[model samples]
Target chain A: MQVEFWFEFASTYSYPAAMRIQSLAAARGVTVAWRSFLLGPIFQQQGWNDSPFNVFPVKGRYMWRDMERICEGLDLSLRRPTRFPRNGLLAARVVCSHADEPWIPDFVRGVYSANFAEDAEISDPAVISRCLETVGQDAAAILAAAQMPASKQKLKAQTAEAMERGIFGAPSFLVGSELFWGNDRLEQALDWAARAAR
Target chain B: MQVEFWFEFASTYSYPAAMRIQSLAAARGVTVAWRSFLLGPIFQQQGWNDSPFNVFPVKGRYMWRDMERICEGLDLSLRRPTRFPRNGLLAARVVCSHADEPWIPDFVRGVYSANFAEDAEISDPAVISRCLETVGQDAAAILAAAQMPASKQKLKAQTAEAMERGIFGAPSFLVGSELFWGNDRLEQALDWAARAAR
Candidate 1:
């Protein structure tokens, strides 16, 4: 069985999920379809223009603390980003346009590392290009392709699909119709996929 | 080490948590101090008159579904409350006034079962009295005690303490200064307490 892992680059929990899902899914023989989608539209529809964490300060405080514990447990590095949610539009567009590419996973991890660990501005083309280059992908051509009208439309459609599927947050895993949200639910999702196969 | 389990009777997730936490904590040699509090003030501080789940329909829908899976895994029966977030003020007053009573745990579980499992109106005195009676306590006497000014003041103070401690929601756990929110974090909170003792 397979699981569709939907993530947004700006999501804090997605960083750990992205870094771990590949190996975890492989161990359970669950193929993962990495689906990069934006939470912008979803939040906007719910009357929020920013991340819910920022919209709710207490939650924002708890989230950072929770992320610190999660990162420590996962042996991942974390730094509070200078910008709460540096625009992930360009990075999302790039990943959405190259979803099926062989270098997508490494590129995904690199973007996550840049945003969370290094606090680099993910919206900056330079940061995204560095992530692409690190994965041995042709950065210049890919960046140009990501800006194409078709690529933009793909991301838009993907986001719409996510909303229609009732995704209210990032790092959601869809095992057929069973939707599991958050990084915490990753193991359960993988187990669900493996069990469904049996 | 000890963990303070702060919960509200109207909170949906608190049902499973109340049912399971005592056993789990006991198994880990962790002492649990049940702290009943209200979410009304906390939600008001965040500019909401209703539960965040209800204010955001998408999240509410997801929450119910998620609860189903969690309850199934825990071997607990759950039925959606007919009224969302039935007033837990009276229940909180009772629990808060008698925080250290030997029967407080059972009383907490009884109230949760009434709201979630039986779909009873938790605000109804008859319902609460029945819960108290089931726990082998004098229903009328305890109910009368719950209405005393002293009882009311105790609940108010407890709720204030929860807010000052950065509790934004119900079913939160505090191990000294470390705050863990949600039923999912119960295990981690217990682990933290257990480790600290060693």
Candidate 2:
């Protein structure tokens, strides 16, 4: 079955899922597609101007601790990013520009690690440029192209596509027509994908 | 350290938490006070007339599978109950009436098992009566008391108290003045309780 992982670079739980999804999907003999999309538009459509974590302090504190525990259990690196909900506009644009490239998954994972594991402010052009360079892509050209009109339009189109799919959060998975939300639902999504393929 | 477990008998996730809380608390040398409360009023205050699980099918399905996995991982028995969001009024009253009783925790756990492990409809007086009888309590007298006008009022008052404490879900725990909602927050609540007690 073909499974598409829809993720946002700024999402906390998406970090672990992005880090392990490739190997896990491969082990299950499933084909995976990586999708980088911004959750800002989806949150606005849901009548929210910000992440729910920023809206609820108690739940937010619990989320941070829970993420720590989950990351430790998964043996993944985690650093609470100083700049949360960083503007992933440039990152999203770059991913959209290379939407058809096989290395898009690697780029998405690199961006996630930059924001979540390295505590870098992903809204900074330098940070995103560094991430692209780490993945062996030409940082300057990718950054320049990402800001091009066509690339910006493509990013907006992808966000609109996610909204049409009823996506309201990061780390969502789409298998055929079914949408599974959250990192917690990754296993079920994978199972559904595997069954669909069979 | 002292910990108070605020749970509802009809709560899906509370069954496993109730089954393990005592042992886990004991191992940590912490005392646990089991307080049974109804979730109906909380749901109402949250502007919902039913269990969130029943209101959202996708989340409900995910919860069932997640509970199954968590129970299996813990070597605990879990049977999905037929009648969900059961009228926990009577059961809550009984716990309130026996609030000072030390054996109330065991009785609460028994009720949880009857609902979640035995797949029993806990709203039925007969089921609750059977549960009470197993704990060597006067089923008829307790059932009669649980149905009293005063008992019903007490249940309402306790639910109001839960809302005031910022509780929005079942199987919550109170560590000092902090309220932690859901069974998944059990360990973190205990840890907080331990630190607070010190």
TM-score of B chain for each model? 0.98, 0.93
Encode model 1's per-residue lDDT on A1-198: one tens digit a residue.
999999999999899999999999999999989899999889898789999899998889999999999999989999999998878999899888888888899999999999999999999999999999899988999999999999999999999999888898989999988899999899999999999999
User: lDDT, candidate 1, residue B126?
Assistant: 94
Question: In CAPRI terms, where does candidate 2 land?
Answer: incorrect
lDDT of 1 by residue, B35-150 (tens): 99999999998889999899999889989999999999999889998899899888888899888999999999989988998999989999999999999999899899999999
Task: Let me know the DockQ for model 1.
Answer: 0.74
* TM-score for the A chain of candidate 1: 0.98
Q: Least lDDT summed over 10 consecutive residues: which range in candidate 1 chain B?
A: B89-98
Writing each residue's lDDT as its tens digit, candidate 2 over B1-198 gives: 777788887788888888888888877778887777887766665456888778755457757766886788789888887778777777888998787787677788878887778888777889888888888888999889878898878877877777677666778888776666677678877877777767
Candidate 1 segments exceeding 4 Å error: none
